[model samples]
Target: MFSSIKKTTQKLINLGFQDDHANDVNQKHVVNFSYLVFCFGCFLLMAMSLIPFIPIVFFVSFICICLAFIGLRCNYLGHYARAQLLMPILKMAQVTLLTLFYFGSESGFHFLLLHVIAYSFIVFRADQGFTKGIIVGVSSLLFLMCAFLSLKGVYLTESKQNLLLVSVFFFIAIYFSVVINLVMSRLKSANQYLRVLAEKDELTGLSNRRKVLADAVNIFADSVINRESCVFAIVDLDHFKKINDTYGHEAGDFVLTKVAGKMQSVIRPIDKVGRYGGEEFIILMPKTRLPQAELVMEHLRQTIASLVIETDKGIIIPVTISIGLAPISPEVTRYEEILAAADKGLYAAKRNGRNRVAVSPDFQDGN
Candidate 1:
């Protein structure tokens, strides 16, 4: 029975202190809701602590419960940051209240301060104000001094050993908080690096095929789920194989890298471009129609054809890309199918002697 209770307690700790991450605001709001619910449960536990002391305990619990409920409701109403910030403050207040219940700053429940430290690390993050750090330092020092005064018989404390132990544990809590924060900061840095690497094509610094496909899937899903619109385009370099065969692989790499840079210069931030495969690229245009997507692709094609790259050997490498364009509609059930339709248009561009934008006839008819 005791072991079962221990397991349940561990699960609750995991739910309360874990870091929940997301790329969307809605998901972050959900995380804030989950945290507030945990705070509600904490308030319940605090109320039970004062069971024999009726009215006062009921009032405190009622206030806390109200705060938690308000925070949860505000999440749906779009006050995400406020909801996130309030829960931690509520937790810190609870810890502060526990500290006041014991004399000489000695209480076994003082270990609960660890939750405050963890919450600050998670919520405030590195870029936030240092006020949390200041609070922690001042409170810890005040508790330590109180413990010392109690040992010197200047204050009340029936057990010197317990007070000393609690004081020592408080300092230990500080040490653990610092260490954990440092480690988590490192992990967050490493995570950011990994994310960048995953999204970029290492050789040319363009978006990779995998990243592009992921974006397409997400964009398509969002479009269908929300009844939004988007367009997909494929660009393939004209005579790319001949260039590789004529100028050697190094020259080919230089040409591809330069072309990617030119494309990046002209595209909008909301538009995504990726190296789809050898000598080919794909783009996703959210909230764009077929005509708009075609115009954008035409501009990109002309820009690529006009730009001339001068090599170290004074060789001017002239290049152009053939583009196939297709807009996603409600009828298209899969991203891959949309891509295939674009590929068909791209093949037509290649057949029509390249360096131009070709729209899928199938898409036009459906539209």
Candidate 2:
């Protein structure tokens, strides 16, 4: 039952928005606020209909409903500025006119203008300072005007005035609560997106150098304490600069992204792969010795060598990678030492030939 209600609510919130705007946070917020206005307008119209109908009160409720429809239509047409402007205007008019002529100050209708002021800040972007200030100033002036004019006389009986006072206050409290909660939820989602951008490579979508190094340090420490084997390898694309110069930078980028994906697919779940920098990557294999790492790196080298990348101009480019492997030793005191050993082996592989894996001399004797 709860799931059905949630789906129905989602459909209403997405009403009138195009499918392309499904991920737009600001657009969703506008639709939700407009829907709230429409619902409240309906509530007021029904409540006034049930009571001893005053023509003025009924007229104001009907106008509120009409303005809400206008707001929704503006948002649907992508006129966000107009829709935002309408919301404050609608609230200010409803509260001020209602307080001035009928409900009066005793009914607390003027307090709803506070919501109008708060809504302006939430809906307007930070760059819209002038527009936001104008909305705030106008709403404030109208609030004071209602308070002063309401002192003249109230049309409703004392009992009816008290009941309306409670209802208006309750509505104001609920509106502010929902607004605050929505703001907090959006903030959390934005922070999470920022964290991912900081730690991951934008182009290749792999762990970046900083994150990879941090994880390597932690994994290395654990391996030492637990007496487990760990292997570190540095992989570099062979003749990558020539590929960029011959085909084009776009082709080079495509090759890099595809190679990263292929490496990820071949590695074990316990292994970690990251983009160390331009044309270079790092792989960490936990609980794997030098001989075991050699087989894995050799498979990766063959896999990359077999890759065929077709460019936009219909040129086919073949790619290859050279790898350097270093295993954790008792003599290794820090993660940097292991990394330096791997660097040495990478040079060895490059010197001998490309598209091959080379093991560090320090580990060759032991393995």
Candidate 3:
């Protein structure tokens, strides 16, 4: 039973002190909510402590709860900076109140001040008025002075053993908060890196096959429903295998990377390009007609044919791509249908002699 209670208490602590959004407006709102909730708990504890006749507990808890509420209100009203600033002030007030109850800073309440200083650094980040280093240094010195005075039996008349135990509790709380914040920050960064890897091709840095296909399907569907025009294309390099055989696979990779970069440079931001498979690239252009797509593909083909790749061994490799083009329409609602239609025209371009653009017959049929 005691272990279960301990676990529940730990979960509550973790929820209250998360350290991600002190500087972000939306995130600050969430942190402010957490602070308000923690202050509510403090208010409840104050009610229980009232019987001990220590009026400072009730006074401090009341002030903290009011400040927490004000911070939350400020965040909701788009005053996030104001809300974040309140946290440090609230912690300072709490420390002062605790010191009064303990008779002096020498009563071991100085540890709570250290916790507040570190908490400010975690919450306010660089946006605060003072630097974290200065706040931490000053707080640490104050805590050490209080500790020295306590050792000499200055001011605080309460039991020395009890005050020592309170300092230990404060230390544990502050230590855990810092550790949890570091772990969470690392996890957030790692997740962002993994997301980029999932959506991009490793070699060319173009959209990977899966991501491109998914986006193409959505764009096709939207165009179909809205009666808008979109062109689907398949671009295949001519003699790609022969290039790999003569110049080596390294040259093949170099060719693919350069071609992808060239395509990106020429294409509009509204269009999407992706590596469909080995030696095959896919492009989807929204708000484009058959004639416009033909012109774009022809220009791309001519530009690629003009690019000269000179190997270190002095072998000049001239590359060109055969393009297949088709427009999305009522009959071409599915991405598979569009891809298949473009692919058919692609093979036709190869048959008619590589380095040209071919459009599906259905495009002329007005379907």
lDDT of 1 by residue, 63-166 (tens): 76778767666654767666666665664555455345432244444444555455555555455557558645655654454444432322334564365456
Q: How many residue pairs clash in all the candidates, one count each?
A: 0, 0, 0
CA lDDT for candidate 3 = 0.72
Candidate 2 C-alpha lDDT tens digits along 120-186: 7777777888988998999898888887777544477787777777887777787777677766766
Candidates' RMSD to native: 15.8, 2.8, 14.5
lDDT per model vs. reference: 0.69, 0.82, 0.72
What ranges in model 2 sit over 4 Å off?
7-31, 34-38, 151-154, 157-159
TM-score of 1: 0.54
Residue pairs clashing in model 3 are none
lDDT tens digits, residues 54-83, model 3? 576677788788878787677657676676
Best of the two (1, 3) by TM-score: 3
Provide the TM-score for each candidate, comma-separated: 0.54, 0.89, 0.56
Judging by lDDT against the true structure, name the best candidate.
2
